[model samples]
Target: MLIDSGSPGAPATIGISLTINGEVRELQVAPWTTLLDLLREDLDLTGTKKGCDHGQCGACTVLVNGTRINSCLALAVMKDGAEIVTVEGLAKHAGQDGAMHPLQAAFVERDAFQCGYCTPGQLCSAAGMIAEGHATSREEIREAMSGNICRCGAYTNIVDAIEDVMHAGAAR
Candidate 1:
């Protein structure tokens, strides 16, 4: 159900469908609109931040098709029909439903964040890394998460949270 927002070229707009946070969103966006801009500005999914917008800071990291990527470097049009999960989607199911994801709970238990600005990206990156399942040690986790920068210097706690989740998954 992609709605034709407008035509391409001159004032060209393209219609794209993205499954964001388990919801299908059909939107009309410009070709040059980066995924970061599209999420924050158009879709109003601001959980993916815009730090260092050049794909360096990884603040705009999100899960696209089950892989972690920097949204700031991706064009919205390029991700048509992709399944995207932002930080907002991480804990959608909560309370009695046992909604909070393990990573989220671990962050709270480990005191994984300081300024909290980088928490979203950090969470998303950890989720993706855990899914990838290549990192098992603290050093590997840090290396995998190097793209996301936390200026408040909460690296140790972040690693602890991620490691807890990984080991828990192994036990399961």
Candidate 2:
């Protein structure tokens, strides 16, 4: 006798084990599922915004072993045993209790978002960009973050927030 798995017309589920936000997680998911879907749907880590799932937009950016990558373009099965860090993970890692990351605080102080739809992605990208030491100047920051489109046109404020963190050496 064969037991039916709940997925109608779908193949068998694959088990994936990964470390996310400093926690070990095990899930049975489809092989083709993207990391973004797993994080949001399964892990409840919705902080990793999904703007353009095609990787054209950096909104779905997340840190993989400290390197920023578009989660939407990555397969969850491919990240087995890898460390995944989303915006929520970053916040937790940067704080002790309920405090926010320096960049998050700077963004708030500078009002870096308008509709705030892109704020999560912007903050995540900014955090990774700053950590990578890729933004040496305002121009570089702007260039590095160009992949993240802010439809609200909060570019100036975004730069200000990132710069504030950079100048304060808080990106470390």
User: What tens digits encode model 1's per-residue C-alpha lDDT throughout 56-171?
Assistant: 98888998998999999999899999999898887652221446778888989999988788888988888888889888889999999999999999899999888888988831
Clash total of candidate 2: 0
Off by over 4 Å in 2: 1-10
Candidate 1: residue 153 lDDT (0-100): 91
Cα RMSDs, all models: 3.7, 3.2
Candidate 2, run of 10 with poorest lDDT? 1-10
lDDT of 1 at 100: 71
In angstroms, give how far residue 140 of model 2 lies from its true place.
0.8
